[model samples]
Target: MRIRLQPLAASIAVAFAIPAVAQTPLRTLDEVVVEATRERDLPGAAAPTAGELERLRAATSDTASLLREQPGVSLYGAGGVSSLPVIHGLADDRLRIRLDGMDLIASCPNHMNPPLSYVDPSNLKSIKVYAGITPVSVGGDSIGGSIVAETRGPDFAQPGQGLLTKGEVGTYYRSNGDQRGINLSATVASENLSLSYSGALAKADNYKAGGEFKNFTATGRGNELARNEVGSSAYDTRNHTLGFALRGGNHLVELKLGYQDLPYQLYANQRMDMLDNEQKRANLRWLGQFDWGRAEARVYHEAVDHYMNFGMDKQLVYGTAVNGMPMYSRGRTTGVETKAEIDLADSSLLRLGALYQHYTLRDWWPPSGTGGMSPGTFENIADGSRDRAGLFGEWEKRFSPQWTTQLGLRYERVTTDAGDVHGYGNAMGNQLVDAAAFNAREHKKTDNNWDLTALARYAPSQAIDVEFGFAHKTRSPNLYERYTWSTWAMAAVMNNTVGDGNGYVGDPDLKAEKANTLSATFDWHAADRRWELKATPFYTRVTDYIDAVRLTNNAGFNVLRYTNQTARLFGLDLSGRMPLGNTALGQFAARGLVNYTNGKNLDTGDDLYNIMPLNTRLSLTHELGGWNNAVEMVAARAKNKVSDARNEVRTPGYALFNLRTSYTWRNIRVDAGVENLFDKLYYQPTGGTYTGQGTTMGINSIAPGIGVPGMGRTFYAGLNVRF
Candidate 1:
């Protein structure tokens, strides 16, 4: 199928370059793979499973809002500006995100940056998403997958004494039947150092309940409340990202700094109130390609500062005479990482990398008179750090023009330390614990890991190709899970209580989660057609699967524990694009993707928590001269599967509609789109749990059912100009 669409895709690429699009063309709808290893596109990647890059200068909000159309990917509704991607069953820290080859970590328990939010969509040269085993160059601690966002490189457009400048400023207002909100952004870029920055501040009155708001009373009679709380449960947010990139000769570099603050945000899925939340990050990367092969390197650091409260359905105040005051706690994290890659000959590639990070956490209170829970503010402050290093190599040999195979291997070492930390009891929630003093403990541990891959490709003819691959990968535990102490505001806790209180004590004893992956794909084209199709099926087995579970000690709150257990994830992906005729009018196209995941917890005999549900995305796009437009429909069946683990909540299913349009002219372009067009109401089919307000001083947030409810419908628009 891919064989037939290559010519049509090529022809459209040519027409898209003329007139309006020539001035500020978005990424090539169909890019070729070069260095992406698995599927390289422009600076990003060429895989169709990925979404197209809409011009950032023409974007309405943060990049996270743009990716909501992807299948199995949804936003965790804190508000418009602060949303997190629930990637196929895996969200939060499970996914590995990189910018210009550098890693960016989220600090907020609520997850502010949410991967796509790190880079101004307008500044992105391209975005490549690898939902499967992905290539070794992009692998690390990634069990669900990887997403690489790249900035525009120098000499990417035209070489030799060239000056290009582009910028945009715009605002949009949305009035759905129940609520209203507005968003805006500004961006600019150039060849020497591309700079694109965007900021959005927005608020919405409480939405009219789609159906009925349930009132859970201590009595058996649950009341059916009217949807009359207009503006009563409203929320607000502020999000921004500033990115700069320098491309010269064979050396290219990029840097991005971003922040997200969502205060007084309302969520229908949880029992608490988000009074304060913040996410801050700085990411840097450098890449150089020599005559031999190429080299890429990067470093990044970020911090999350968070505070919030729950327990009230209406206005309440407890601290400093604040109205509707509620129980509140705070926590923070500072982390850093660095990595490097070097490509050898066409047949051989080598990569070496290391990551070091530190996290200091404190969970405590400041006299909330609302309840007797504030015991003169007892606190637990602990320090945690991670040191990791690895070496990897891959070699691909082409015996013939139609046949090629590649083999890869990686070895790594990791160490962890938790110093000067204590777990609090009674005062926060645990009874066996001390409320008047800080419990202190120390520990250190190390681990060794290995990865392997084998790939084979065959081409009966130039237009048809088939590939099969198998790989083994493993990733170390994150700093938060292995050495977290105090309380997680989102989970509504006051102690590091997962794997066991031992996790907070710093279990340098933890081992890495290992995965064995197998995959097969086919790309076929007709002899004389403008069409193509691609399909892939995969299965992965994880040994010593690391997960967070409630502690058996049952002291004050649930402690987060990390342990390896056997688990499995398997699914299929299929997509195709076709052109009706050779002319510009017949150049319309259609594409779609569907994926699924099913796994078991061999240790406890339960389903994996918060796994992605079966989902699909279908899009119809058209190209006519200087004008391009598209409409996509996305849907996901709810995952009713509930884990047998205690405190686990199930999520609900949801569907959304979206539209995108763009027109290009000489040095000018305009692009606009609307997501969740219908303002539909739905929650994640998989849910998570946090402590309820006044429940205790230990935990804060939780996914209620399967998952939390996503955002209602939204619309975005923007413009771009180049000189």
Candidate 2:
């Protein structure tokens, strides 16, 4: 049946004008009114407001850094713009991340090009996170949480307005790393159609710590770095996006094309650095609003070509026998999703959705010289593929003014396979034996996973509310965890993902990880909502957790293989904001948050790696008209409960101070800030090991136990112009 969009549009307009508080008659507007669009989401999901984003974007280029203010969120340092976000104690592949409705995958073995790296901070229009208790609508083979980030899109003009145009230009610079960037966006729109474009360029050099942390400056490449500088930490990248949208009454059709070119992104933790990475993406979506509910369908495709080698800071030549080790990876991902919302009644709603994704990858290393690498091409993961198909349904009901509940269930069929692999290793390790063993096994494997979530909310009084939820989540292993075959120190270290300075082998017989989580949030606010306090406590127990088993120990570094075990994690988050009386200078406010998490392996009694210690941040903010200013103090407890299996490094407790201020006037805005004001030297507990410099090709070439140091005092400024 063909539906008329005009009637649907009319019905939706009437529904939008209907007030929930009263039966008021509609009035024709004489002037255009602009408002932000809100997407319907589960109760627990949260997003940063526009004002917050404006403040944070000036200080960072890494998109993952924008989530630092969110409780229970942390970041794993990587390339300059490719920091990996961690929810609670789980990081990387454990979390489901989506950009413009596309599920992107990291093509590199070391994960240098994460999904968030594709979008610049200045280009984000909306970003949200659902921690722990994720609804089936956004949940699949992920156990930690879900994140959705969308770039700015077209905004249609009024029905009678003719040809509207808008544009913005922004630039930023930082002193510590000599980092600089610029971004531009433009849009042309009519009542029924819109065309938009956005682009960004960013680059940085190696950054230095507050003081000298290393004793030598040799880079094994005939180059020398400053004693205080952290080598292999530079990057250069560019991004471009084009978007188009058409609207007819209540129906909307949107298309977006994106491209990224990264010349280089040096890494401080991995043995190899990204020399070049290119990505292309296309997304198409259709959405409609009906009197009963809403419907949406989306299709997306992505392609990536990635290359890695020894950046200038690492050993490039081995006894003049072999050239720099070169690695390459290519990947393609295609996905389709369909969803619908049905209004069962005034107080009840139901949602159903289905999605399918197919992904393929090829990782190889070509021979570079007449030495051990001259024999044949090394096939790390050849013709590897992973596919998933999922179906989910959710129901939500409002029993009364004070009580509401939601329940959701999801089912997914995941299958993975890989072609045979070969290594060019010449008597270095068990390459032939391992490859033969892997080839003899059945590469095809399948898993049927299930997810369930139940949540409820209660409001006892005007000043208090409580939300609680329970979830059972399941996750299958990524290809790197089940396919990589070699155990050679050189090849193994290239496969490490956790930044523990250890090489890891894969386990094909691994079982899917299943996590059972319980959490509750307590929110308290004043009668008028002038002040607020919020606290969340969560606990999770996991069966068949993919940890590692040590295979060889050399010095402090070790070689390990993926294994299954039992694990558990618990955490608490506390945040509050209060307003001080207005003053002549500005309106002052105080806000702060405290986060703590603990993780342990129940089977081995070892602490989980990369777990953040207890940390807190306090800020004093001031605002008056076009002026915004703030001073922040951040502190953390010592990370003493280290992971014993990988010999995790311990970092001492530290405190730092930062100052920021911004002002806007008419069409121009400026932001300036100083971080690490005192220039205190400190180590990042999760920054991984300090194998960023010298002869890092060998597994035990450098001394172990040195954690990557944090950056020194830095001044930054940003400018934006709108027309």
Candidate 3:
């Protein structure tokens, strides 16, 4: 149904309202009347030129391809969908992902649940990404950054009358040779409740690499392909989610359940190839407000059953035929958290929270070669748990009506416990090393972190709101980085050595990492209401920064261990939106963004590895007669700075262009767009190379190395409707 408002009545109401004298009008006229929730905005230097939600929802290719237009993001993989996101030079577990209020952990060695694949863009209402200095509410020690995906919410109207249902379905076919996909989402909402669901299925054949690849061992001997061109195995994915919510005056309750299954081929980064990844999760939350305070409580549970194997039939293999050898693992996690906020006085608020989590890991390695039901060693079987609690408070006061200052402080304590586990060494050795005896006995410790923040804002004139902020934050190490013992994936192996294969192992006694952050932001609105701008500058100094370090040993294979080092980084971000006025062509607008970050490893006197290069985005959008059209251009410089003490790879930069248009008629909407218009052959400045080799080693011989080059041109179109 189409609803229309009385234009004459709106015009008359606006004309009778008193206008601000010598000041810019607010973006929305009734802004002051609406309750406001302060949202953490992206630091000026890491914001994307255009968001990925819409384009990604209708993507025909992989998640990485859909997001390539954004600055400082990169992907690398054999096929399209398998590529992962590299933000500010970090990917994998380094980046923290949050769905609503819970954390989703990926248990697959090959990273089956990258942030994009976990939540189909079609199901998202909005996504806010903070490259750094994310709010404390998100929790988790994130050295890289954070991505938050929020689902649609209930739409309530005038006390008792509300009905709404909306859904969208889309499919795309690509010419790149062998890939296709379908995506769908639907939602229904009433005054008291809402339901939403989304699903996506994708498939792709092997990819043709732009360079040659080598099949060999670490000793410089094995299969070799002069020119690298091969396709990946066929892979498929299915995901579904159901959510329910109840809302009353000051209390809200939400329940969410999610299921995901991906039966896929093994990639190069994995030790064993995965046959299936089944994941299940449940989440519950209750939030309530009281006369003097507010409280939020949450609980979450998740499980992962992963299946993998070793298969031999590749032409790159030297005259050999091997059957699949199956291996499997099961991972389970349960957590509960709660927080309370008290309104102490007119300008002060106290916050307190506590969290508890338990994790169990077990894996089985089936005996190989014979193929019969033979039981292999169950090398690792460990149970771990963590308990965390924190206290924080914020104080805000206005010196005058136009000036305000705020201060905040927080303290947290974390304790961990883990069972004993084996150590890392050559599994193929003729004799076993009693290395397990030397491994540090399992134990537990309590780590503490502190945060302090201060902010000052001044509205000298109604047209401008200037602000400045300073904060100091610290983070602890994660379980995986400090305790994982695994083999190298084929992709990482082939790329790390000219033919010398190797992999990484976990360290049990790793120390906690720490960082101190400082930042300032400015918001300005032109007196004429024709322009808006925002800028932020920040600097961070990290001591005992943790990293997966590759040992320089030249034995038969490579070995990696985790360690802590010192580092420093600084950057700037600027963005603006301007109105260009109506023309014979149409009503036009312009928006642009620029971001840059530079980092260095003080311990080794080298630049931080995988840092994104300086990048910028500009776009022109036009609107006329129910139609919206836009053209965007993006470009970035290559990151020449690199770590010399560790294995670090440098990525070259490139420029790209895209176009989008949409038409709306009543309850129907259509969107279409073309990406990488010029089909430029460029690479992400932070894209990772095959993981087997450290960065100091060259990747010229690795298959699909040089970090998968950016994809060629592609196009997509989709439709939405309400019923």
Top candidate, metric lDDT: 2
Relative to the unseen true structure, what is the C-alpha lDDT of residue 199 in candidate 3, on a scale of 0 to 100?
A: 75
TM-score of every model versus the real structure: 0.74, 0.94, 0.79
- Candidate 3 displacement at residue 401 in angstroms: 4.0
Write one digit per residue (lDDT tens) for candidate 3, span 43-137. Answer: 22112222224544555445444444433344444324555555445455555566656666555434544545555545555444444343444
Question: Rank by TM-score, descending?
Answer: 2, 3, 1
Write out the backbone clash pairs for model 2. Answer: none
- Give candidate 2's total backbone clashes: 0
- Which segments of model 2 are wrong by more than 4 Å? 1-48
Clashes of each: 77, 0, 17
lDDT of 1: 0.49
Which predicted model would earn the best TM-score? Answer: 2
What's model 3's lDDT at 430? 13
Query: How do the residues 1-723 of candidate 2 rate in per-residue lDDT, one tens digit apiece?
Result: 122211121111100111011111111110011111233111222223345576788899998888777677888878889999988889898998989778888888888888999998888875666664777777789889877777886688887888889998999999999999999999999988899999999999999998998888999989899989999999999999999999998898999999999999999887889999999999999989889888989999999999999998988998877889889999999999998878776577788999999999999999888766767889999999999999999887777777777788999999989999988956658788888899999998899999998877777777776668889999999999989989888888888787777888998888899999998877777765567777778999999999998998666888899999999999998877788979898899988888899999999999998999999999998999988899999888999988888989999999999999998898888999999999989988788888898777788888788888888999999998889
